[model samples]
Target: MPEQVRISLDAMGGDHAPDMVVAGAEIALKRLPHLKFLMYGDQARIKPLLDNCPELAAVTEIRHATQEVTMDDKPSVALRQRRDSSMRLAINAVKEGDAQGVVSAGNTGALMAMAKFVLKTLPGIDRPAIATYMPTQRGETIMLDLGANIECNEDNLVQFALLGEVFARVLYGIEKPSVGLLNVGIEELKGNESVKKAASILREIDLPIQFAGFVEGDDLAKGTVDVIVTDGFTGNVALKTAEGTARLLVHFLRETFRSSFWAKIGYLLARRSLQRFRERMDPRRYNGAMLLGLNGIAVKSHGGTDALGFSNAIGVCHDLIANRLNETIKAEIASFEAEMSKAEAKNPDNVPEDTAQ
Candidate 1:
């Protein structure tokens, strides 16, 4: 680990203000004593909360900001009008080298707009993708485009594949990770033009990626592929459907357990197993959604998540900084662009005749 990894927090962005933010910082510090937080928000609101956790207060330095971006605020409005807001300041810390990353349970659009404007995307990247982890049968898998870009082209999908590949390799240390396109079927003719073209290009690329063809909705939870690439629309729909299904299953399970006297007895005996299942399904463990492809790390926590969930978001930022994820992504992108450029130079008019149109 580096000497230190400091994180900037938008204390007033979430449903719970300074209290949950400060408490979450305390919880994160317990696990990462070396972690430092630049708390940006109303100092009067946060100082009292810090008083309750004296140790956390020692490592945290508060920066007073009277303004805050509310949930209803438009991304454009927040970016243009709220320069002194807590969210903007936290992101500015990253650009200014005061922190490696920023975590916020703030307005998603505002946060994204401000972050993009401030940190900017890395070279060779058109738009940043939102990535998050999901528990799978084998272990855990990372998925991208969780509602960042609504529409994408062949190049966009291919770039998302690259994004996910670097994330898995750096975060999980997977030597060679398999990538798949989310589609209706596994056939070559499946999906729209963008996905088909993306798949075709991935097959012929000289990259060190294991392209696993196309995967349907069923393959997501089966751990069918290490990374599933798709446009933001499909990815967001898939995410919401999965979440709704999980909630329905939980409700049915709870009712089933309450159905009979014998069921309660069975539940008592299997309590530990059920508890483990609950822990695996806990949304708090997967609280942070990363705005991948930025020059600096920016993680967005769920707006309504509690203190425990916010702490997990901070941990995600910590992991990214400690692993130098942006640097790794930059290196891969440079290699990818260089190889493609060499291929173009081989053509007479620098036009890829065999390339997909």
Candidate 2:
């Protein structure tokens, strides 16, 4: 028999709480047969929605919690004080082994804070970083520390690169994924002290990953590298900027095409291709962000995600569970630790120093 994946979803989280959350859960259950969802929130509101779709009742189990953690509450306070918050309960399900993973579209800070407290980090990993998959010219590149840890060190960047490589290989099916340190310049001598030191450490690491030197902001959408590693601050800025640019460009395209009859006719003539382009560039298709270097799987979705976006996140969670991504990451990290230890023993004084403050 195949392994069953039970996911705990915080139904009351997100801007479209309960409604979109419920709808996404329904879509996931209908599309994926092996998925079992534990919806955590008030039962009264969720039941009516479930009643509208009787068939989903069989696959989804509701764990009622009266209170909810709003996006405004501090994550630390919410985690400690709100014992019955839906987000906390959902994470508890994963921590207690009642569910394989937890998915939420709540406050990003609170979710990260709660996740760190509940799931903890894998061995040899100091912190877990938020990683997202971006479509690049080369294919899909894994961008790490998107917003998880704003202040990171050279050690963090190196570890992020390793984790990103493993994720790309497992999730994207890229063998020996080329790794690049996000920097202001492509030259080896560019960037701050941290990036410079991280590049050196990466060069010394003997792993299956192919270190592709430094990459710039323009290189992200151009698909110059498979995995882009940077501090959370830089990565978050780059990701948001890219997202804004993509949206602006698409908006402009739509306006241009709809402005005149000739353009509308042209759009109609190329409707299929236009739809394909939209699908490819749509951020909703890549809504899930993985909390990498964790002991267990925890996926975070955009706080404002709609039903369709949440559905995409569910599909991503399903894919990660089905592929046993956490296990694969565990093995890869272990191997990396062994390699680092051996290298350290051989050249204890020669190990590159971390430049991140």
Candidate 3:
């Protein structure tokens, strides 16, 4: 049998804490026999949930954490002030090698702050970006820096593209994934100064992946490119907008179908296709955001996630751990660094700061 992958979960991190979190843990344990979970939170609250699942109780362990970090709290302050908060404890578990990965539905800002502080960045990476996959007509596209760092420079955008490319290649099994810079227009001269500068740099570099030029917001759901790169602020806005629009469209469709007997007949005729479409677009299927370029494995879920969402997040963590994503990313980054070093040595003065070792 394969060795078990242990995960540290923040049982009190989300809006539906202790219930959804505990329920997700139970589902994960049931689905993955070789998976062990360490739940961190108040024992009193967690114990009652665990009582219903004796099998999970046998394999899972609970670690006591007294403090809780709220979404409104400043990330830096929470990280510094709350020594025993569930988020901190869960991250510490990964840092200390007690768990192979950490899963949380906690305050994203605080989680990112604490993760950067604890896990640190890989050698060539200046900053860690949160990457998430979304289902699209073509398949799925990897979008990065989703609300992790709002303000980014041209160099930051380039790094996010490279990181996102490697992530798509590894996680989605795409060979030489095509990377696209999120822009307002597809023309080379379009977008702001930062986008223009990044595009110029991207054109100059000869990366292992394919650079597909610029992609607009509408191109995201169409999967016009394999990887989409942008600053956290833009990426976050685009993601939330897509999610909200999908929800709204689904609601409108359901209301239209239920309005009349004729509409009900039409709905029944298209129900199978609609069901498949809904399944493909369901946010629960893609619930976790990966903190790429970090040394350790850290997966973040939506703060308002329910049990199904949390369970899917655990499954994502399991897949990442099983696939040895950290090792693969490290190797890819090392290769990129070596290539950059060689290029710099040959042309020292002209080497771009973004690609320079």
Candidate 4:
């Protein structure tokens, strides 16, 4: 028997609604047998699908939700109106201690807003950050502030570093992960004021974090460091650009293969190798974007993703809760804060007071 990890699902949220949610749960059950799903949605739609998958049905308990957050609903509107919605109800389950984490494929902004409002940020954390793992040459690199905060100050970047560092350990099982600040260039005077100032502060800080200086655009795929920290604006743009580039490369490869008979013959000869490469680059393998620094875990699945992608998202939520990631991050932040307090007391300029937004 494996350890049980309880997760709440927004069954009626997503482009495909209850069908994809149920199907994803079925797929996740095969991989994580110890998962207990607290399915939140209209029982009428979800139960019918659960009946067909007895393996998942045995471990799931459906909770009725009359409403659901729509894809187009703004975060503010969703929070103001959709109280009994499936997404909100699922998050509430985590808040009420009924589930360890919540997984949703609904509106991204709405989910983040609700999770932040409901779960709140962990101790010593001013704001929560969004983080996710992307495959790199070394293995996988953890990147943070991926569409959570549009514009962040130096202090916020430092906070993202802390969250990303903790998540990298959970992701790669490394004790002390090398953290880097994303920048235009690696030179000391090349980047903007924020990156330069952040690097300066991180170098001065006396914490457990392994500050790995700055990483440029080309360093993303090189796996320059285990953890990449940036503002949500930059991180989000980088993530989208990477995804687009991957698709572009795959398209070019396919076009080249079909351009000539000899090319097609060559493709056939390398089909097995190409397939391995394809599987390695698949985005579904890295589907979950965790909203970090929240008191409880919340994983956002791509709304357009299928059963396989959604299952991967659920796995992220499970691993996060089982590893007690939030507790570890809270502890790390507390430890750093204590150290900073002592330094600040000794020298007023040790840790600059964060007054800027």
Candidate 5:
């Protein structure tokens, strides 16, 4: 780990704007005192918040951004018109070596566009994928392509699997993490041609990954594998659906507790256990999503996250920088490419080809 991990924050990017961003920084700074911040946004709106947190202000440098990218702005429009927006400036800090990493809670598409254009993808990586870790029955599981590449072929799926594999190792300190493709069923013949071919290639590869074959949607919560890889379209839908389900469950618990006087007494008796469950299921703890395969580190904080959630997001950025994740991914990609070459040379027929494409 570096003596200091400098993070650039899009102070005006989230739903709560400077307030959430500033408070999150304050919380993160307590946990990571060596952190220095580059706060980019309208100085007028951000200064007052900083004033309230003198400790944060002491190590922070605010850069005024004239424009702000709105939540409704299209990716292309935000990239072109909001060149001086807080989101762009924060990302620019990373590209210019002014910061070790950048965090944003703004428009996801816009952030991806700006990041891809500015930082570019790592060598041998065809595209970047969105990855994050979530709690499971057994433990935390790493998943990728959560809305980065909407339509991925066998090549992209394979790359996501490799990326997810690396993420599990780096983030969880896992050795030879089990990797699975998200599918309609665990059976070999249960998916589209791309997914089937992707599974085939993964099985044939000699990489460090433990390819677990196809895993159904139900397998996600079961921790059937350490890492799950899927195209963005499917991954995004799954992610949103899971989030909604969590909220729904919470609502149901609330309603159930208030249904009767006896239920209220039961809630008081089970308060401690319920608190533990709440902490385990807290979405705030899993607020950060990494744009994997990028040359530089960039984490996307949930747009509606509060101080605690955003702070968790910042923690993620710190971990990535401290772990030298990109360097590890580069080395892994090189090895993967070498393995592919060897397999193709040894038995070309074994390597799966995308016949549909």
Candidate 6:
């Protein structure tokens, strides 16, 4: 870890407001003692909460933000109008080098817009992709473009693949993580023109990536690859579907155990195993969604999450900052660009036939 990891928190952004935000910071502080927070929110509401936690207050600096961005606020409006809102100010902390990263349980679109406008994309990166890890049968897998860009071209998909690869390497500690493009089928002839073209580029690109030709939706949970890349529309739908399925499974198990006396006895006999399963499936364990490819680290927490979930989001920011994720991604992208230039020089005729069109 660095000497200190200063994180900016949008204290009034989430549904629970300054209360949950302060509680989460206190919890995160216990775990990561090196953390210092630049809390941005209405001081009138936040200061009293912080006053209750003397230890957290000792390490935090509150920056009063008069404006507040609601969940329903449009990204364009938040970016243009709410410059001093808690969300924007927190992000600005990172951009201004006052903080290493920013965390917000606020408007997703607004956060993404402000982060892009403020921090901007890294070198050689066109668009930033929202990435997060999910528990899989094998372990955990990283996936990207989870509702960031609704519509994507082949170039965008390709960029997401590279970004996801870097994420797996940095966050998951997988040196040669396999990358796959989400498709309807694994066949070469499957998927839309964008994915097909992206697959084609990934297949022939001179990068040191393990390109798993194609993977279907089922492969996501099957742990078929370490990284799954797709457009935001499909990715967001898949994410919500998986979340609903996890909750449904938990509900079914609870109802089954409580349905009959014998079932309760059975649950008692298997309670330990069930508890492990529940912990593994808990959404709070995976609450942070990383807004990748930005010049600085920015993590978006679930707007409706509790203190524990928000603390996990803070932990995500800690891990990303400690691992120097952005610097590694920048170097890797530069190397990839260099390799592409070499390929172009060698095949001036037609090696890279613009398939992204």
Candidate 4 vs. truth: CA RMSD? Answer: 1.9
Q: Residue by residue across 196-217, what tens digits does model 6's lDDT show?
A: 8888878767898889989988
TM-score result, candidate 3: 0.94
The best-first sequence of candidates by TM-score reads: 5, 6, 4, 1, 2, 3
- Candidate 6, 73: how far from true, in Å? 0.4
Candidate no. 4 TM-score: 0.96
TM-score of each: 0.96, 0.95, 0.94, 0.96, 0.97, 0.97
Regions more than 4 Å wrong, model 4: 349-357
RMSD (Å) of each candidate, 1 decimal: 1.7, 1.9, 2.3, 1.9, 1.6, 1.5
lDDT of each: 0.90, 0.86, 0.87, 0.90, 0.92, 0.92
Off by over 4 Å in 6: 353-357
Name the lDDT value of residue 227 in candidate 6: 96
- For model 4, residues 47-145, the per-residue Cα lDDT tens digits are 889999999999999999989899989999999999999999999999999999999999999999999999999988888998988999988898988
Backbone collision tally, model 4: 0
- What is candidate 5's lDDT per residue for 205-247, written digit by digit as tens? 7888899999988788889999999999999998888878989
Per-residue lDDT over 199-250 for candidate 2, one digit per residue giving the tens place of the 0 to 100 score:
8877887877799999999888888888899899999999999999988998
Stretches > 4 Å off in candidate 3: 352-357
> lDDT value for candidate 4?
0.90
Better of 3 and 5 by lDDT: 5
Error of 1 at 312 (Å): 1.2
For model 5, what is the error of residue 109's alpha carbon versus the real structure, in angstroms, after optimal superposition?
A: 0.5
Q: Considering TM-score, which of the candidate structures 2 and 5 is the better prediction for this target?
A: 5
Q: How well is each residue in 223-292 modelled by candidate 1, as lDDT tens digits?
A: 8889999899999999878888989999999999999999999999999999999999998998999999
Mark the regions of model 1 whose C-alpha exceeds 4 Å error after superposition: 347-357
